[model samples]
Structure formats: C-alpha cells, structure tokens
Target: MSEPGKYVLAKPIGEAEIGRLDLQHRMWLTQHHGLYSAPISKSSKQRVVDIGCGTGIWAIAFATEHPDSHVLGLDITLPQPNSAPANCSFAVADAEGDWSFATEPFDLIYGRMLINSIRNWPRYLKRCLQHLKPGGWLELSDVAHRFFAEDGCSEAESPMLRWWRVVFQESSRNNGIDIDDTYKHAQQMRDAGFADVRERVFKWPVGSARASTQEEKVIGDLQYQNLQVLIGGVTETAVQHGDLPGMTAQQAQILADEAKRDVVENSDRHGYYMHFATYVGQAPR
Candidate 1:
C-alpha cells in the first residue's frame, strides 16, 4: 500500500505518468465529444469544478474553450503546470473531504476516470449535487475496466486479459472500491436527487487491426500506447496488492508484457476493447 496522503494507485506521480494521463485526456476528447457533454458552454459566466482532476488537462482545456467560465481543478496532489489560463486554477483537495473550498455553487462539476480511486459513489454524487447550483450539471466519464471481444474473438482465452480481470477485481475489493461503478452512474445520480440524467457509451479499440478508418486507426494507435503505460503503472500495485494468486511483481510484469504483445501482434485473434460511459445530470431548479 502507498503512504498516507498519496494516491492509492501503485504508480508514482512523475513526468512519465503525467504524460500518459495527458494522452488519456486526448483520447477521451477524441472518443467523447470534446472536453464535456453537459450544456455548460451554452451559458456564460459559468463556474466549473473538476473533481479528481489529474494533471489539470481537462480543466485547462475547458477554461481555454470557455474563457468566460472560471474553472477550478481540484486534486489530492497537484501536478498541474505552473502557468495556467487566467480563468483556470488548480487546488490541492480531496473529493471525498469536506468541500469547503467551493464557496459558491458551480454551474458544472466534472469528473473522469475516477473509478479506481473513489470509494463511495453515492456519497460522491450527493456531494456533487450539493455543490452544484440549481440547473447546473454534473458530468462523469469512466471506463468499465472489463475487456470485451466482438467478431468471434474470445478475450477469455488470453492469459493477459484473464490476469488483468482477476487482479484488478481483487484489488478493488481489497480497497473497498467498486470496479464496475461505470454501470451504476445513472442510478447513483438519480438517487442523489439529480434530474435530466443522460448517459452515453463508447467503445475504445485497443489496436489498429480492427480500425477501418483513418481516425479510428489513430485512436487505436493511441489506445495501444495508453495500454502500454497502464501495464507499467499497474503491475507493481497489482503484485503488491496480492490480488493475483502466487504472483510476484516480476511475474505480473511478464503477464503484462504478454498481454501487451497480444494487443499489438495478435489483435486479430484477441480483438480487445473497453467500454467507456459518460453520464450527465442536472440539479433541479
């Protein structure tokens, strides 16, 4: 386990990790429609809060796009650049803590890729709702983390995929976090008293073999790089967590290498992809 006040994930915060996170942000922008899907840009003078903001990329982009809006990017450990857009600010804060920093209600509260870190969905959603202004939006985007195969490719037959599933599931269980919370976003939002909830799902291809168009091919290439970084980041943590039976860090790295090779070389037989969900809801006016 990591030390107190550190991120739960095994990966250390560094330049390489930050670069990977930025790549992920770009991939999400390409996968989803722009930085966010809420009806926030339609109005001016919007105050936005980005919960669990990593590297502050999304917040900076949103602030750049909506100069009239002031964006607050909050994270437990701030790795954001020293210089930011005039309308954007990065703060060190925990999403699960008392949100005393939010002196005023925000027009939008956004979070992405927080499934691995957040422990309580209901409480988090309630807090988001409480911090939101009436008619304001709360948007969340997360990957399911479960791999799937279409076109007769069986991911179950891949040892890498199987190891990933078991180890990650066990890790989440050990940490008391929900690994499949992406599926529960809508229900959680509704239960938190949010209205006009909407959900969008997207499939992210793992390799270029399945891509038919130039854009999809580019996305696949990026996804492959992202997976490589993910393997490096998670292997140590997964082994330390002892989720995989009789697995050492070296053994986990071997399996991760095989899995990455499968994505790159045997994608035709593996055809792996992940499902990402984007959920948006509004505080009742």
Candidate 2:
C-alpha cells in the first residue's frame, strides 16, 4: 500500500525521475511523430485538459502549438514552469477524485502512462465522458509491463523480467488496480458511450543493439535509461508491499545493477521490445 500523502507511483518525486519523465515525453513524441496521435489541430478556440499531467510538458507544448486553445494540466504534484505559455495553466489535483474544477466541457482530454495510477478505469472513463463536449475527444497512452523478445534469446527468462513481473503484479494486487489496463481501453470507452474509437500500438526496443536505424537507436537509448530509473522504484515498491518474499533492499539493488549490466553489455542480444498503445475516442455529437 502507498504511504499517506504519496501518489500511487512507487518512485519519489525527485529531479532524476522528473528528468526521466521529460525524456519520456520526448520519447512519446518521437514514437508518435507528434505531440499526440489524436487529431487536435484546430483554428478555433478549444478547451483541453490533461489529466495526471506530470511536469506539464505535453500541456505546455500543446498550448504552444495551438495558441487559440486553452490547456489545463492537472496532477497530484504540479511541477510546472514558473512562466508557462499564455494559454497554458496547471493545477495540483488528484485525478482519482471528482474533477469539479472543470466548469465547462473540454474539447480534448488527454492522459498518458496512467495505467498504474488509476484504480477504477471504468469509472474514470465515465468521468471523462461527462467532462467532454458532444464532439470532444479523449485519448490515453500507456505501455504494457510485460517484456517481449523477437528472437529466441531467452532474455525473457532473465531475472530482470522476473523482477518486473513480480513487482508489477504485486503492486497492482496491493493497489487494487490493473497496471496493464490499457489493453481494455477501447472496450471501456465504448462502454462509456464513446464513438469512433481507435487504437494504435507501437513497439519500443529495450536496448541499442537491436536498433538498426538512427531513430531506433535514440528510442532504444532513452528506453534503456527509462528502465534504469524504473528498477529502483519497482524494487522499492515491492519491498514496501512485501511483494517479493525475503528480498532485501540491498539484494534488490544488486539485481537492478545486474539488469543494467545485462542491458549495457548486450549479453543476451534478445531484441526485446515493449508494447505501447494509444487509444482515442470521441463523444457522441
């Protein structure tokens, strides 16, 4: 269980993790070839809301891009720039609670990488539906926790994978949430009375060895750093929740070190990749 006054994510809100999240925002942009997969370009005034908007990077960028749009970013911890764009604003709010701040319906509602944070996804979607205008769009981006290998390198059998499996499973169990809930996003949106639902999936390489193109290498490198930052938090969460039986903090650190070594050395050359999914739905007009 998460301690009081702390968000659902296991990691501490420090410079290192905040920096990782900024890089992750860049990675998502590179992966999608833009700020968002949904069609958000509009010449007229539009109201946009970003739920669980860490760092407010995406909100700022979108506000900068669409000057006519007013973008509101909401999160538990609003670590935003001192001087944001004229059209952008941020607030400290919990996504799980009632969103009474939204006085009017939003034209675009966005969320990213919130799978682990959200407890009741169906209710969340229903709330999103209520806050969206008749023709408004809601988009969510999330990644699967499970690892995959294209080649028969057996890296999936590695201790790193084992650690992630246990940590994510136990974390979800303890929090009463589904860490891999994005797989059901489309159905959930439909159940919430959304229309024109669409889903996109991307493969994110784990290491640079499998990256043939320059873009792939960049994504791979960023992903490698992402994993490096995640291991510690995963282990910490596992220890806090007593997920990994008999695993000490020192032992967890050792495992994290070994996992980093394996990735850096490319010892297995497993061509491992993770699945990133984007789901978009529109409210009935």
Candidate 3:
C-alpha cells in the first residue's frame, strides 16, 4: 500500500530549486552541530550512515567534506551522480528491513524528511541506535505539514491548506503510516536511549522577507514555489483517484491556482512560514 521510495513527483522549479536540494542537505548537517563539532576529527574514527539517503546528495557532500570518514547512503534506489567521492558510496536497502551490511557501529546516523515512509517510529529509532556506536550521534529532521503565518502577516484560510492536509492524512493512512509529529522527535530520541538531546526549529517564510529577518528571502520564495508544486501534484493525483474525499475537481483547481498565485505574486501582507524541525542526540556510552 505504501510507495516507500517516492518522495516527490513534482516538476523542477529551476536550477536554483535543483541547487537547494544540496543547500537543504547542508543546512541539515550544519544544524546538527554536535555531530560536526570536532573540526579536525578523523574520518576513520567516524562512519556515517544516511538512512533513506535519496539521491545521496548529503552523503556525497559529507564524504567530500570529511574525506577521512566513510559514508554509506542507503535507500531503496541507488540513482545518483556517478562522480561521487571514493569515500562515499550507496547501497539499495530498506529501512524497515534487516541491514546486515552494517554490522559495525557507525559514528553518525542521519535521516531527514522520510516521515511518510516510516510506519513505526519506535522500531526505526531502535534500529538507528543499534547501528550507532556508543557515544555516536543521531541527527534527524522533518517538516511540519502546516504552513503558518508569522505574526503581523495574516492570510485568509486558503483551500490549499485544507486540500494538502486531506491528501497527506489520506495518503499516510493508505500507506500504513500515521502522519508524524516531527516536533516531538526529541522524545523519540530519548525513548531510544539517546542522551544530550537537542531540538531546533527553523521557519521559512513564503516570499520576500519584507518581514522575517532570519532567513534568506529569495531562497525561501523559490522553496515555497517548489513546495506548492510538490504538495499540489500529490494532492491532485490523490484526489482524482478518490484517495481523498470532499475535494471536487473545481476545488482542486482553485486550490492549485491559488498556490501558483501565492508564489507568483509573492504577496507580502499574507505571510506564511514553512516549519522545519531537527532533533539531535548522542547514544549512551
């Protein structure tokens, strides 16, 4: 019932959008400061594993940054740029299945945005802990579904919100996964026997930062556009196939058109924020 590896079926927004995948990857790594605190750390002392590694973008970058560390990017598909660093490699594997290839404990475990595929958080956390060496670090991040209004920027309730929520809830139910509460990821880490846990939240504004000062406005705008396409395409397909109820063709079209207008107009008065939360913890020594 679950399409395990299908992340997004949306069209690419631009080269910038293409590039942001790497940016997001890097931002995620930077946010997990504990894992990279040792600037001169040896790679041989650290083995890094990225679960649901996707295109291996993060894995490749990590390998390039830390040549001493062997990085393994494991996912269901091994598609990636052929020119990856020698220290970085990929393997086709399922996170829900046994991972015999990684009997040796790793120094770091990284996972991001794989919420929809993981049906059991406890099991997933246990697996992550088992493969992590004592005192190793686990850094995980996920996005909250609600795109919100940061104070002073108000928006009338848009159909996009309703439509996207329905699609996510329905799709997750159909896929045997409950929608994840990424905000509580720290709790999961603690339950998994992790120590020194920390969580940080990053908010991305919808358009030009005429308001929010902490983030790059243009990058956020482009990311907002890309997100519309991502969520819209999935919701449209699901609604068309009757996976979601109460969404008429006309409503779907209206929501899709509104989403496009939101990005194109870059409306400042109606500000919304995309929420990204990251959790980091160290395994018990």
> Which candidate number would show the highest TM-score if scored against the true structure?
1
What TM-score would you give candidate 1 relative to the actual structure? 0.86
In angstroms, give how far residue 218 of model 3 lies from its true place. Answer: 4.0
lDDT of 3 by residue, 29-61 (tens): 333432232122243546988888887766776
Q: In model 3, which regions exceed 4 Å deviation?
A: 1-44, 151-156, 263-267
Q: How much is the lDDT of residue 29 in candidate 3?
A: 38
Model 1 has a clash total of: 0
Candidate 3, pairs of clashing residues: 43-68, 43-69
List, residue by residue over 45-95, the lDDT tens digit for candidate 1: 889998888778767767877789899999999855756789999889989
Q: In model 1, which runs have C-alpha deviations exceeding 4 angstroms? A: 1-21, 151-156, 212-215
Candidate 2: residue 8 lDDT (0-100): 15
**Candidate 3 local Cα displacement, residue 52, angstroms:** 1.4
Give the lDDT of residue 9 in candidate 3.
18
Clashing pairs in 2: none
Residue 149 shift from truth in candidate 3, angstroms = 2.2
